[model samples]
Target: MDEQQCWEIIEAARDDAGQAWDHLDERLEHTLTRHLVKLSPPEVARFAEFFRALQHRVNREDLFMAAFLIHHGCDDDGFGDFRAGLVGLGRDWYTRALQDPDVLAEHPAVRARADISALMLAGFRYAPERALEELTGEEYDGYYDSGEPVRLDDPPPQAAPVPRRLEKLAALFPRQQAYLRELYPQLTE
Candidate 1:
């Protein structure tokens, strides 16, 4: 019914208590909580309808985002990394995310996805392992590896490399132009 009540269901679901299952407001928080705890097939089915109703025109996304920040703000490491990221999300993140085709492919909730991802990245930058408060010149050597699943303050990807000269070279043409890509199974789409 309310945020507090919804939160209880979330925490209960996270722990798999199954006691507060009824309290969850058709919101799928309970289902998501279950998914986070242990993803099951049936729960996955429920998420379709749930998220459809749950994430619409940024309103629900904002609510869900706020709740997530409240519930999981502290990422066990006792750092406010996530909080800082969410609050500090800027235009650059939004702009970069817009350029990503896969990001644009996420229809209906495109804006929400962009917002969430930007926040997540910025927050990860503040994480305990290697916070990129201010990157050094050496650290900015075309690559800023935070050494984690998330990138810290690395700038967005540059223009894809153009194989001009390599493509023109008859000898190197076959070897350079999409050669390794075709050769390696993983490299090919």
Candidate 2:
């Protein structure tokens, strides 16, 4: 499926959950899987491709730094989960975040410091694969040919320069830094 179609599926899942951030991991996975199961296997596979591609789009150091500050120090796995959770926020929020990671400071979940990891929306990261498995009675291996590397555990080689210190990250994302301070009043620049 194309990017727009991919977003529609996620948006539908968000709507299915009444746009509430609570228990979104289970809710989004169920809704997204329900939508994917109705499609042909190839469509499901294509959706997986697009999903990974979109995740890849946000695999940058700036976003990683934003996640680190928001989540209180992000590792590789945390960054991956954070990216998936960002996608789960829907297209408009995702695009705005792409333009300015600082905008995340205004997000309700971020303001509440909710865990934006596998427990949030990353369970649906593999929803298309799960749907394919259910439909074809076999595990999905369609992601191998998406032309993107499968090393979600590894930072991308072309990732932008990550600030080496919290002070630098704070300087780069002043708005987010302010929000972070609000979350952790003891934190200092």
Candidate 3:
């Protein structure tokens, strides 16, 4: 499948899940897995490849800062899930986020400080791989080689004091840093 088709599948699953974030993980997994089951193994693999590529696109320091600000804090794995969450937002938002992660400040979930576990579930779900396993009765081996790089932009800076970190983050993403300051007063205090 092509990139647009891959996004269509994700968008379909998102639409199928509707407005509620409850059980979004399970609903999305079910919808994506069901859709993948209809495709041939190669097509399923292709879809996974596209997903990986898209994930790579958002694997940047500035976007990671956005995730960290939105979620309060994000570690290595949390960043992975954050990228998946960004993808789950669908193509246009994803594209805009790729260009400027501060746009994420507009999202309701980020604003409400709601349970965002479902948004982060895509990285953990591994739906395409799971579908491949179910289809072939074998584990999915389609993954980037060990040599493949994950970051598409600069790496995050070394750890430092919260205020100092905020300065750097504010420099990189002023809007997101401002959002974080407003949402979590204790952090700024």
- Give the backbone clash total of model 2: 0
Q: Against the correct fold, how does model 3 do in TM-score? A: 0.73
In model 1, state the lDDT of residue 46: 33
Q: Candidate 2 at residue 127, lDDT? A: 80
- Model 2, span 63-175: residue lDDT tens: 77678677656678878888888888888887777766667777777666565442235677778778888888886554425454433332333433433235544654577
Off by over 4 Å in 2: 114-120, 141-189
RMSD per candidate (Å) reads 20.5, 6.7, 6.9
The superposed Cα distance between candidate 2 and the true structure at residue 48, in angstroms, equals 0.8
lDDT of 3 by residue, 62-133 (tens): 676677776656788888887877888788788767666666766666555566564576533488888888
For each candidate in the order shown, give its overall lDDT on alpha carbons: 0.28, 0.70, 0.68
User: What's the true lDDT of residue 128 in model 1?
Assistant: 15
On a 0 to 100 scale, what is the lDDT of residue 47 in model 1?
30
Model 1 whole-model lDDT (C-alpha atoms): 0.28
Taking the tens digit of each residue's C-alpha lDDT, what string does model 1 give over 74-180? 23222233323222222332333323322322322222332333333232222211111121212322223323232123343443222222112212223332443
Model 1 poorest ten-residue lDDT run: 128-137
Please give each candidate's TM-score.
0.18, 0.74, 0.73
Q: Between candidates 1 and 3, name the one with more favorable lDDT.
A: 3
